[model samples]
Target: MRLNNKVIIVTGSCTGIGKAIALRCVAEGASVVVHGLEQDLGEAVINEIEKDKGVLQIEEITNEGAPERLVELAVKTFGKLDAVVNNAAMILSSNMETTDLAFLRKVLDVNTVAPFALIKAAFPYLAKEGGCVLNIGSVNAWSGEPNLFAYSVSKGALMTMTRNLGDTLFRESGVRVNQINPGWVLTETEIQRKRSQGLKDDWYKDISSVYAPAGRILWPSEIAAAAIYWLANESGPISGQVVDLEQYPLIGRNPPKN
Candidate 1:
């Protein structure tokens, strides 16, 4: 019950890390706003949370005034807000030659700008409760793989925003902001993505030991655990941090020899 009676908004909660965080928050006794872009997945999450006496709201965040509307939904349903997890992101591939201005703008709009919008909208509510903002960033923020060029750039922008807002909000209004840079999470999207690339069904066996030092990449719930830590009141007075949740050191990491 680490988050009893707390209220949090988790964007992209219809699936993957976002969904896991929403479920974990509900289990910990928090009312959650399970925000996402897909209806079926959102409904599934809402059904699961309902069983635990959890107040879960399903909303989409990809339109004009979406951030404000989402915050309004949380307050209207749960009576207040405590925190926000900016987890909605697009992971499209684009290398040097393929990355165009439009592609980069689209990536930034979702992966970077939307987060800033949501936090700004949720700020008043969070400030009233001395709440926090936890952004789900990536190891890609450390200048990711060439295939993830646009994604890496967007995440990098988000990392800087996290620090900037953490300092500004804490100083101006007592709200804490932090970012978690997860490395190689084995989400459903990743599973299918790997398969589409012609990897075998058990592609799970293919991760290099050096990349997956623990013998596996991260799971969504592991990231959720960290989210709870940052959201819970017990993690007091700390802000403006980017935590790296990777098996290997991110900076200057080289793949091990076969």
Candidate 2:
């Protein structure tokens, strides 16, 4: 019960990594507020939680007042807030030729602005409770593949936001901010996207070593484990760290042999 009696908010918890983190937090004894755009998927996640341990709220992160309402809901339901995992994001594959400026702004709004808004809205409660803000970033924030133009840019801003706030907040209000940069996770959306790109049904089974050094890509649960450690108070007095979760160092790596 590492997080016993804690109250946590996990956005985009309807599926994939966000769902895993919410489930993990619940298992560790936290009462959770699960937010997502999909009603049925959100309910599906809720069904797995222990009785009275989780509440589901359907929300679009980019909507007006959504962040404030989310924070208010968590505080209202749980009586207070202890942590927030800003895990909701929009990912699209488009190169410069295909990506328009408007779409790029839309990506930034969802990926970066939304997280920042949530952070601000939750700050008062977090400060009172000495809480944690954990952001789910991507290794692509380092410089994604050319096709992920807008996505990469958005995540890069998120990285900077994490560091800037982490350094300031923990020192000022005892609220810790941190981020995780994950690589090649095998989530439902990713599988579907890969399939749409013409990959075979068992594509994961044949993943190349360059992408998945352990013979497979990362699992959402694996990322959740690290997230829990950082969010838990036992880690103590640490903040502003961006962990690169990958098979190889992100920079200066040799090109994969195709």
Per TM-score, the best of the predicted structures is 2
Q: Which residue pairs come into collision in candidate 2?
A: none
- Model 1 alpha-carbon miss at residue 214, Å: 1.9
Q: What tens digits encode model 1's per-residue C-alpha lDDT throughout 162-181?
A: 99999999999999999999
Q: List the residue pairs that clash in candidate 1.
A: none
In model 1, the Cα lDDT at residue 225 comes to 89
Q: What are the clash counts of all predictions, listed in order?
A: 0, 0
How far residue 239's Cα lies from its native spot in candidate 1, in Å, is 0.3
User: What lDDT does the true structure give each of the candidates?
Assistant: 0.89, 0.93
lDDT, candidate 2, 1-258, per-residue tens: 999999999999999999999999999999999999999999999999999999988979999999999999898888999999999999889889989999999999999999999999999999999999999999999999898999999999999999999999988999999999999999999999899989998899997788778999999999999899988989798899899988888899886767
C-alpha positional error of residue 203 in candidate 2 after TM-score superposition, expressed in Å: 0.8
Q: Positional deviation of 47 in candidate 2, in angstroms?
A: 0.5
Model 2 alpha-carbon miss at residue 61, Å: 0.6
